[model samples]
Target: MKRMIAALIVAGALVSLPACGNDDTNTETATRTSNTAESTTVQISSVTSTADLGMIDQAKLAAFVVAFRTAYADLSQDRDDESIQEIVFSSCNAIADGATEQEVTKEIRDLAANDGTEATQSQAEQIYKLVTPACP
Candidate 1:
């Protein structure tokens, strides 16, 4: 009877050990998941603010158009359609409330040069609203 009781106790201890280990692993996993979720939430909030500011402020938008035109003229030697479009879109989108024509032009030119393209007339015209209403 004494030996039987000892064996039963040993069996219980073995089972309980695994349970304790499993609990620790579960706790660690939960902690990691919670931290990951929090980080993702922070990133999402930052992206939202950035996107909100990405929208056009009309005056600055006009300046961006002017910049794109200037840059296009400067880089007309090696123009690519896709690159021009990209520069026009990116520069116009950068226009904020108080941006100047020179500032916008410089941005557009820099973007165009970096992307290896000249701004197209159509793309320039599209962005031109940020600077002039009569850009054809």
Candidate 2:
């Protein structure tokens, strides 16, 4: 059940990702950056608001989200099974046990600003809004 929910949330985020529009610049950059990311592993070191890492650790949280999305995309779209489970587990492990909706919302908002999704910020905002509450 948890996996189902997580997959749905990720699917929704992906669906919403394009709704807000992915510009050529961001697309190109994401493509170029993803090329070198083939062997990189993603993990979420801090999951909750109380964690000393805090949302203030924007790099951690942003990278976590980006990695999570990338892995999720790879699993569903690319159908790659080799390291998907490990990546997903690491992504889930990054979230602390007591994370709150507010903390996650703030994290999403902050990351969205620099993600080149400003033109459709509200859509990204909605995606995270749906994702945070469902976080395990």
Candidate 3:
């Protein structure tokens, strides 16, 4: 009777051990699935018209230009005006690629408006100067 009881206890522990491990694996899988779902939901707005692109406010445009300049600075070694233009145009072209004509027009206009003011241009230039070294 004593031997039988000991064997039953050992058997119970073995069965419970697998349950604990399975619970951990299930938790890990659930976490991974949630993260993947969140990542896939990341949305990039699709522009439908040139007017919609042009409608971007000045503040937004400024931010976009600053972002563009920063991106350009990182991508180029020579930060001349020509280089800046090349980078900017290339970036615009990329945004337009596979996009509708309206979308391309809107993107260009928005970019142009972003640095329309001297203050914004200066800010964009500053960002460009800061990030130029790290560009690919």
Query: Which is the leading candidate under TM-score?
Result: 1
Rank order (by TM-score, best first): 1, 2, 3
Pairs that clash in candidate 3:
61-114, 73-132, 74-135, 75-135
Question: After aligning candidate 3 to the native by TM-score, how far in Å is the CA of 65 from where it should be?
Answer: 0.7
| Candidate 3 accuracy as lDDT | 0.38
Which 10 consecutive residues of model 1 have the lowest summed lDDT?
53-62
- Candidate 2: regions farther than 4 A off: 1-38, 42-97, 115-121, 129-136
lDDT of 2 at 47: 28
Winner by lDDT: 1
Ranking by lDDT: 1, 2, 3
Report how far residue 104 has shifted in candidate 2, in Å: 0.5
Q: After superposition, how far is residue 1 of candidate 1 from its true place, in Å?
A: 99
lDDT of each: 0.46, 0.40, 0.38
For residues 1-136, could you state the per-residue lDDT of candidate 3 as single tens digits? 3433354455445434434547779688667656754443231113222222322222222233344444433433333443333334433344445555444444434343422322244434443342232222
Please report how far candidate 2 places residue 13 from its true position, in Å. 16
Which ranges in model 3 have alpha carbons more than 4 Å from their true place? 1-54, 74-136
Question: 1 or 3: which has the higher lDDT?
Answer: 1
- Backbone N/Cα/C clashes per model: 4, 3, 4
lDDT of 1: 0.46
Cα error, residue 21 of model 3, in Å, equals 60
Q: List the residue pairs that clash in candidate 1.
A: 61-130, 62-130, 62-131, 67-105
